[model samples]
Target: MVIILESLLGSMFEALLDYSEGFILRQEVGGVG
Candidate 1:
């Protein structure tokens, strides 16, 4: 049970990181264009 929760939290954190990075990249591209 604990292990499952840990894995779930890890994935969520990773997804959040990916989303923020993508958002920042989009902003940079928009600025350049």
Candidate 2:
């Protein structure tokens, strides 16, 4: 119930963070190149 929801939210947040970091890195590389 609550535990499951918390785990799901945590994983989603982590994934979003990773995606954002990757996106930023790509944007910087594209801007430089």
Candidate 3:
């Protein structure tokens, strides 16, 4: 149970981090486009 929660939280945090990074990448790509 504890492990499951920890993994879930980790994935959620990773997704948020990826989202922010992707948003920045989109902006950079937009400028290049």
- Residues 1-33, candidate 2, lDDT per residue (tens digit)? 999999999999999999999889989899563
Give the lDDT of residue 12 in candidate 3: 99
lDDT for each candidate structure: 0.93, 0.93, 0.92
Give residue 8's error in model 3 in angstroms.
0.2
Query: Model 3 over residues 1-33: C-alpha lDDT tens digits?
Result: 999999999999999999999889989899563
lDDT (Cα, tens digit) per residue for candidate 1, span 1-33: 999999999999999999999889989899563
Q: What is the TM-score of each candidate against the true structure?
A: 0.80, 0.89, 0.65
Candidate 3: list runs displaced more than 4 Å: 28-33
Task: Name the lDDT value of residue 17 in candidate 2.
Answer: 100
What pairs collide in candidate 2? none
Ranking by TM-score: 2, 1, 3
> lDDT of model 3 at residue 7?
100
Q: Quote model 2's TM-score.
A: 0.89
**Weakest ten-residue segment in model 1 by summed lDDT:** 24-33
Candidate 1 Cα deviation (angstroms), residue 6: 0.4
Please tell me which model should have the higher TM-score, number 1 or number 2: 2
